[model samples]
Target: MITKQSVIGFIGTGVMGKSMARNLQKEGFPLHVYTRTKEKAAELIEHGAVWKNSVQELAASSDVIITMVGYPQDVEEVYFGEAGILENAKEHTYVIDMTTSKPSLAVDIYRKAKEKNIFALDAPVSGGDIGAKNGTLAIMVGGDEDVFQRMMPIFEVLGENIRLQGGAGSGQHTKLANQITIASNMIGVCEAIVYAKKAGLNPEKVLESISTGAAGSFSLSKLGPRMLKGDFAPGFYVKHFIKDMTIALESAKEMGLSTPGLELSLRLYKELAEKGEADSGTQALIKLFE
Candidate 1:
């Protein structure tokens, strides 16, 4: 059973991972962190997290391991090889991959981990960097119900809205559904701002009227102002968002789904990336409209 005494190993200390790991530490869990870049884990180290030199070292020592790496390939690298978590983690160690990756990969990880008596879960999260910083992320989990129950304490420490969707890969499937909604919603959000500005209406005032009504959304309320102020910072990277859309699009096609909105959004994001805005925030899509 997981408790405050469980040593939690966290990999990928990027914009979202860093804050999520820090929250786990604040709740008094002993944290061991590893990232490809040592400098990224520096702050966590200074804040009393134990730093491991590699994934193997961290896996061997920790009771529970959490990974928030970029891309499915990175997930495979951290969990598949002889040096990976499945080989190195102690028997029955609970390994959770919170990265938004392909559902099939999550299922593969689950089967390999189960073979070695490891408990694996795909527990991808939403709410972006702000949600990570605030500990209010919506965590969608996929695993055995008993395992999900066992990890509730740890999940509670990291997020407020946590649910076990179904078996292995369900979490990833749910996250893709989330990205699909956001992909289309982002386009609407950008268009609304552009229309208000072009028509000589104060966009801020217009937002005040529409944001609380039927047109309101997280993208409009949280990111709309950032677009207006030219704050194209990386709350979530465009390159990563594009990666997610590509995965979603591929998954949709495999299921015989036609997603015109998703297709359009993907095309626009690719165009933005081609113009060197790949590292910018999703809110930076407003630049295309401008």
Candidate 2:
């Protein structure tokens, strides 16, 4: 059972991970941190998070390890090698991969973790940096019921909407579904604002009206203003969103599902990335229209 006394080790202190870790620390969980770039973790270190030099060291010392790295490759790198979490963490330690990664990878991690008697969960999140900072992310978890219950205290510190989706890779599958929805919705959000501006309508006032109507969406209400103001700072990066869309596209293909909108969005984002806005926030998609 995880308690406040359980030592939490966090990996990947980028835009979202840093905030998530800070919230955990604020809730008084003893925190140990590791990241490829030590500089990104400076704030947490100053706030009393013990910094580990590598994944092995952090895994060896932590009772619960939460990873919010960038990609599936990074997830595998941190969890599968000689210096990885599975090899270094003590048996029965709860390991949660919060990275938005492959469902297959999540299942593989669960199986390998079971072989070593380590508990594993794929708990990806939504609401981006804002949610991470505010501790209101929608956490979609894939793991055993008992384990989810045991980790509730920890999850509560990081998010308000939390649910056990199913076994093994379900959390990742759910996150893919979320990304698919966002992929298409973003295009529409960008188009609406562009149209409003071109038609001489005040986009802000238009948003104020439509944001609460059938046209309402998180992207519209939140990222819409960001688009209007040309504030493209990444609440979620265009590059990462591209990675997610590619993954979702692959997964959809494997399932014999067709995602026309997802495909169109992916094509547009790749064009945006090629034009050198990959590092920009996803709201920058509006620039394609501009």
lDDT of every model, 2 decimals: 0.95, 0.96
Model 1: per-residue lDDT, tens digit, 1-290? 78789999999999999999999999999999999999999999999999999999999999999999999999999998999999999898999999999999999999999999999999999998999999999999998999999999999988999999999999999999999999999999999999999999999999889989998888989999999899999889999999999999999999999999999999999999999999999999998998
Misplaced by over 4 Å in model 2 are: none
- TM-score, prediction 2: 0.99
Query: Model 1 — TM-score against the truth?
Result: 0.99
* Candidates in order: C-alpha RMSD to true structure: 0.7, 0.6
Worst 10 residues of 2 by lDDT: 1-10
- Segments of candidate 1 deviating more than 4 angstroms: none
Question: What tens-digit string does per-residue lDDT give for candidate 2 at 200-232?
Answer: 999999999999999899999999999888899
